[model samples]
Target: MSSLKPIRKAVFPVAGLGTRFLPATKAIPKELLPIVDRPLIQYAVDEAREAGIEQMIFVTGRGKTAIVEHFDVAYELESTMAARGKEMSALGPTRATPGDIITVRQQVPMGLGHAIWCARAIVGDEPFAIFLPDELLIARNGGAGCMKQMVEAYGEVGGNIISVLEVPRDEVSNYGVIDPGERNGALTEVRGLVEKPPVEKAPSNRILSGRYILQPEVMRTLERQGKGAGGEIQLTDAMATMIGNQPFHALEFDGRRFDCGSKLGFVEATLTLALERADMGADVRAMAERLLNA
Candidate 1:
């Protein structure tokens, strides 16, 4: 087996029904929510492409078929665009080369780990990347392409590596906190992980965000475990079990992460991204100033 098994596949666990964004998500999959112009899930797919992931494995649930269709080529639309000489504008990067996109149904509303397990056949015995569409990372360099960077690091250290960001102590309970041992610049050796621990009891402020380059072993662990916190088969619980056995580490991401799953975070991501657009910058800035003045 190759030491640095080519991370050619990416798994996206997008099965959550998005109860928080109800009514809006009642008919539409929350992954399809717009972050500016593109849906939240599109950003994750784009990130995977940038990281050289050859295949995308979406672990989706019912009412999430649209998520699959979004990546698929819209034959009628493409034909119309081509006829009108608007192919370039109508067809964005989403119309990727054929056979690059694939979707598997999670069937049940289990947790993240269960959703991921649905893609086991597609991921098949290789290290793979997992990107949650909810966490939209905005990088100064290029739209928070953290997974691309992690793939580079995973080449040197053939184990699980996840992109992490330090949240305030009070906010640590909101995420999976990492217990760090030795530090090697941007990469910190992960000793343990505690999922959504109480503020005072958190192991570290560094929390696992959306991006991850996990090894295949994690699948086995998730398979054996029962429902964890919240009566769901948690992904964090499985990752914590692999800490000492494998080379687990956290990459301190150098970017602004937006938790678009929440109303406030979604608004922030939209306004921030809108401000960066050359065409919209002036107007958005002026509006911000006006709001401040008011």
Candidate 2:
């Protein structure tokens, strides 16, 4: 398994319609929706970069060009800021070099699996990562980002690695649960995966946390994959097929994750990150107290 190639590329499936966000997303991509000052896609991209991934592949849709432009140089604004001696250091991550970033179109609003498949031509035959921008991960106490942790684990056991988190047993029904096996510290061998199984038939309380390091072979499985839930090609269903053939493992994320796809989660992520910022922490705390007491 040591012969496994290093994960140099990561796919961001940002083509979702994001109907949950309504009119705001009607005109704009949900990935551009900010957690605070930075957009959700930026958090996901930063996490990929933290893991030493070289190329960032965005599987995008129409009206998602803004997501692409977010990484482009803002000549006018950047030049003006530089002329005024404003700190332009923070813009480094937004600028992507020529081959470092690539975009592929996923015209139809398919499922997560279809969105990822759109990047297969770009991905080639190498191992890659998948980052769902809506699932924003925050490293606790300045630890490694979620994807970094998974990439590290992948170095140890190289086949497939997915980020996992323990939730309530009853709540497992709401998520894709893994049938866990052979545990070594934070890493657990994934014996099987079940997507949104009923509570009575749930296998484990651990849910997939939207970060994945997958072998390219899974793309073959998805080629002829059929629709599962909601008439969409489910990524989980395709992943489950590789359990016996490949070494599948899950890392219990050493941090918190915010499902920013939901309105409540988006609000919570914004407030949480705001309260952690040095410039706004005190003010946010005061605002929270005032609101709670009001």
Candidate 3:
């Protein structure tokens, strides 16, 4: 675990065109979509902050200006809230201090690897984290957030760490499943990675759950990477190259993850999160019961 740098920076790849949401995402970046009251990006950013991330690098594209503005202070809104005596605590988590948030344009919808590579200049030469805003992870029973858990594991392992979740065998092909070598509690020694392998071919049910603590060298691998499974440069392929070279491990997150990129998943996340909030839980439960009966 020598020469391991503290993970201080996190990259959020928010460039994808959210065709899954259609008309709602027509004018808005899907990252700005609200899960309950907070936007999807907020949850991801909050988790990064919890993991001690000092800088946030957002890899964005066209139609992503809303995301930039969302993190900036709204002077007019603040003034209005102050005058109206409205509680300002809710806005605290969404705003980032100046010089802490940075943005880079991907300019093309290449792939996840390409989007992450676009932030290489700003990230420089240190271990950093990647948070997929679409993957909303709710820490089980007030436990540590997903990235926090990965950061703790990275501190001990001192190499690449990716959060993994045990998906059903039949659904393994939908994710980047890991081939396990050894398991010590939540940490699994990653032997290999299969990007969306068939059910019969899947080495394990554990799949990448959109949270990662990665070494900077992976960015260099992505630079020369060619198209993979989706005819676009895949991050999984670049990460797979680092398995033998580094102490790569898969962290099985102790939480529930919602794939907010899809409609069904988005609705599930909204309802689940809403039900978890003390202020709205009762009302949401009542509404859900009514809808179920209707």
Q: What lDDT would each prediction earn against the true structure?
A: 0.87, 0.92, 0.93
- Per-residue lDDT tens digits for candidate 3, residues 72-154, read 99999999999999999999987889999999999988999999999999888998999999999989899999999998888
Lowest summed lDDT across 10 adjacent residues in model 2 is found at: 167-176
Candidate 2 vs candidate 3: the TM-score winner is 3
Stretches of model 1 off by over 4 angstroms after superposition: 291-294
RMSD of each: 1.8, 1.1, 1.0
Q: Name model 2 segments beyond 4 Å from true.
A: none
Summing lDDT over every window of 10 consecutive residues in candidate 1, give the lowest-scoring window. Answer: 87-96
* Residue 161, model 3, lDDT: 93
The positional error of residue 139 in candidate 2, measured at the CA in angstroms, is 1.0
**Model 1 Cα RMSD, 1 decimal:** 1.8
Per-residue lDDT tens digits for candidate 1, residues 1-294, read 255788899999888899999999999999999987889988888888888999988888888889878877888988877899784663477776777888888888988889988888888788899999999986675544788878878888878999999887889988888999899988999999888888989988999998998888888988898998789898999999998888998998878899999999999999989999898988999999999999
| Candidates sorted by TM-score, best first | 3, 2, 1
* Of candidates 3 and 1, the better by lDDT: 3
Ranking by lDDT: 3, 2, 1
For model 3, what is the C-alpha lDDT against the true structure?
Answer: 0.93
